[model samples]
Target: MMRSPANKIPADGEPELPGVPHVHVASVVSALATLDAEKAGLDALAQAMAGPLGAAFDVAVATIHNSHGRVIVTGMGKSGHVARKIAATLASTGTPAHYVHPAEASHGDLGMITSDDVIVALSWSGETVELRDIVEYSRRFDVPLIAFTSNPESALASSASVVLNLPVAQEACPLGLAPTTSTVMQLALGDALAVALLQSRGFTALDFRQLHPGGKLGASLKFVRDVMRKGDAVPVVASGTNMGGALVEMSAKGLGCVGVVDGAGALVGIVTDGDLRRHMAHDLTTRTVDDIMTPAPRTVRPDQLASEALNILNSRKITALLVVDGTVPVGALHIHDLLLTGLA
Candidate 1:
């Protein structure tokens, strides 16, 4: 096996030492070093699974989604932590997943396992004693057992209905005793599985929104309707109104824009800060809304995606969009709203 530099140092009187270990810089270097090994390990795993695991992974995916069954992921030690994250990602995506500790599964938790559920076991060595009981139970009941392990010849692989061999190149640990590259590759592969299955099932951002209801993700999927100014809060003026009246409405609303409605109360045009600048040459006292307002300016549906609306605003070089239902004005959504929601 080839090895890379253990540490980088500058030539000095004694020896310019490497970035201090366990510090921020060293931590980054260690993470990158392990990432390089993980990439190589994944490449090898891809080659090994080209024929053997391609179909097996498909079966595991199909078992969970196509059959109205859940994927029960389990592991011990470091593998268990990775399994928990994998389960969390899978559940947040389109796949229904949950993690079960191997020891717990052997107890009354075994009842949680059903023929409809697929049991996925993760053990780099594939010989965790805590996994024995659940593996036996899965086999006896004929429940699908999908195993991820570096050792295909181990007991875990032998008993699994489908085995995905995770062949890590090497650990990043200098002692080579800690699980480093192995767990990273396993976790990344788990992500790959979730993304692939998500594509297969046509999962959308809306589906993701369902799972992530907190934080920035929830904010990303928020619609324009969620934060738009509605009812009289929307700044508007009649087409017969002078630019001074329109400016008053726009100034009071503090949006730097106003929607001009016709006598029928339908949106006719819009005026913006840009219009104010371009039409400053004209007298505002006598000019009607039409003389300066941009007619039928880009209007968005109140129900449009905030991300999509942000794109439109950015692409058009505009700061605000009129929310109109057909010809009737409903509300106004602005770039600032998207900024407030973190989508801008």
Candidate 2:
């Protein structure tokens, strides 16, 4: 039997390597062949289902979407691992899901199943003995059962409300003892189902950010409003304010720049440290901000994404951006803000 690198260990009498372990080329080739077979299997399954069960796939999505309760995923052995992953993907993508070991269900966990829940059962042959109790319970309680298997005529398939009969394919294992291609197909199908449901439900990136708020993805989806310095914290000076006053505002606000607003409170220009450097030789107390400020400086909207703001800051080689509502400046965003949020 072939073992993956993760499961491989030294035999009883085999000597351990000192350093820089060598990979087995033949094992790698075998693993590549298994990956190729699974790719083919997925293509074949997609083509087969497109012709016959396309409408059924839509029905399954609708059923899962309309259900008031969570999706209960169940399976045994390797299929159980795939089931757990499928449940996690579904939960993270807006569909509520949980994994229940069928063996545990037969003992007492069957009580967790509710009539409002939908059942997604995984079995390659559709005849795993441990899954019998959960299937029976789902049947008796009138919960919708979605079966993922290779046999259409199997008992599990016969009892299901919707059956996703995966294309028959060989196991990648040379001895046909381990599940490789079959489990890949199951995982791919689970991902497809979750994505279809996500699109059907009109799930937005904002909604996804709310669900996953701990990672780089969360930072990427954060809005400009979430991090920008707003209101009185923003450096501002009237369009007619002297360079002396603008400099004082820039120093007081500590944004390294000051926004110049017109009589209507519309941003007319921005005076950065660069502007101060260029005009320092001039009579600073006599020079008006309009004489040295950059007119129509690059700006971002309060509703824009921080990532986009980062892009602007990068492409323009600027250190800060004024967040505006039309011509009205509402906030200020320094590169430090994005850096603080891990978005830079």
Candidate 3:
């Protein structure tokens, strides 16, 4: 194929590719049309959910909640892609789920589906030829089958124990043949199902953190104990220590601050670089730590979430928080630690 000159502009105002034909529609115009079609599909889906779909949705949520076994999500072609994502979302949000390919289920993979499991099948037309085997298997084993399709009267819907009849809408494809808006609605409905299940189970962010422990989100969910400086790394001085001694500890620990503890070894205050600047005087080093320390400084517990610690740092405009066990200082958390852990 011959290539057109990079700087050349065609007389029709369209890029002159070697084999592709020119069309009058601008790319942005086509994108807007696709978005409008998908938005219409979602709007239709929302309306259906508020009307006829509500009762069935409640039933579906109840069935899944009652089931002790995992969710087996299966679909064909484009629906299969969406099914995989749905399965992942479900699994990540406290529900156990797996995606089983419709065609693969025919070749001994059907054994993966158990009588106790619920099958979620997706097909826009509800007549995908590849889903027949899985559908038949669900019936033979008496497994509850949930079907997602626009045609409630089709074979798959008729066979399903729960039918999520999606509202019909035009496809985003100009030819009206591709699975654009339809797939978007399917994915949205799948997300809705997963969220409903999550809420029903009272799934929490801490639980979600367990499933996603290798990302920035995981770092944010970490506890203060996991990132705080412990033992000798924490800079501390007795409540009556001279400012010189407190400054020495702060500089030695390099945390920009030093925790001040009373004779009982309980954190009573904190002296920071700002304190030193504010108390600047020829006799500064002669003064006691209590003279310059900020009493009842904002503190955090070791068990508090790192994100919460970050909130304190941001809201109070402070660089460090002393982690305490009751009244005793156990550790110190510096802003740098949060930055290193990707929580800041």
Candidate 4:
């Protein structure tokens, strides 16, 4: 920790902190220091607020789980940003949540809220004029309300069903008038509530997959069939077929390989580009597909995860795998498909 210079007095006004060093190594160390400080502050705040925050969280989870509606978070200014992030986190983590700016809550947004919903209001001063209507509306409509405010006795806190006192010490800002520390404390408490409820509900990665079924995260959740090429797209030929016919089919499939199937069309053996190279000296035009096909093809089930398929492909150094249903090749998935879907 750097000590305050004796010449740097409060009466001398705000003292400027040193600029981060220009070199990459020095900049990394300074950035790490800031990260460490933020992490410590968040941990400390979480500990300091455990009792009240836990109680409030329990109340919120019980209210939402038992009720037929959602959770509405309302705040103003910097607290509003934290409230929005909290709402997003809660919703993504299995709890239904939404943020309603207090000012907007008065402009017909209150109508969106139902009695079944619980309102979590955040206000550092606990006396924002903009929040009065929604606060009063919650009271009048009998909707359960939980308030977060620095003042336990403020109008907003006093109007709620339960009040979580925010006892942040001082802002990181030298002026001590900004919302820095207070916002951090609120954000930490919000995360605690969200995570506690998340763990309590036994939320799973599969559950999260359902909520975010788009983009990279969604691709990571996909099954083998999601990226597999099905039907005629699969490179395959029946056993005992001539190598000339197999090469023709493999070339048509354009996947660099072919699966040799039996009468059931299920995969029995695989022939790859490497196999062709290995048999280059031999006249494949005279050999049967079974004579060249490597028996017992590597395969994956349609129900298996694509990530597992990727691991298999990487380990085997194969370009593609046959997706089988009880030895029947329903689809084929290439490594390029995984890369296209951002799962590679």
Highest-scoring model, lDDT? 3
State the displacement of the C-alpha of residue 295, model 2, in Å, after optimal TM-score superposition.
1.5
Candidate 4, residues 157-176, lDDT tens digits: the string is 88988788766566665476
Name the runs in model 1 displaced over 4 angstroms. Answer: 1-32, 263-266, 315-317, 342-344
> How many Å off is the CA of 122 in candidate 3?
0.4
| Stronger candidate by TM-score (1 vs 3) | 3
After best superposition, candidate 1 residue 277: deviation in angstroms? 3.0
| Reference-based lDDT, each prediction | 0.83, 0.90, 0.93, 0.83
Model 2 spans > 4 angstroms off = 1-28, 277-285
Could you tell me which residue pairs clash in candidate 1? none
- CA RMSD for every model? 5.4, 5.7, 4.3, 6.2
Listed in order, each prediction's TM-score against the native is 0.86, 0.87, 0.91, 0.82
**What's the CA error at residue 227 for candidate 1, in Å?**
1.6
lDDT of 1 by residue, 1-344 (tens): 55445644423443222655522454566667777877777787677668676777777777666656788999999999999999998888888889999999877899888888888899999999999999999988888898998898999999998788776578877678888878888887798788888988999988787877667778778778887889878999988898888888998988889999888988988999998888886477578888999887888887777777888888998888888888888999878888887766
Q: Residue 147 in model 2: shift from native, Å?
A: 0.3
The best-first sequence of candidates by lDDT reads: 3, 2, 1, 4
| Per-residue accuracy of model 2 over 1-344 as CA lDDT, tens digit each | 99997667645654334443434444555667888888888887789668766777778899999999999999999999999999999999999999999999999999998999999999999999999999989889999999999999999999999998888988878788799889999999899999999998899888898898776778888999999998899999998888888888899999899999999999999999888887787488689999999999999998898999999999988899999999999999999998888877
lDDT of 4 at 201: 81
Alpha carbon deviation, residue 325, candidate 4 (Å): 1.4
Q: What is the lDDT of candidate 1?
A: 0.83
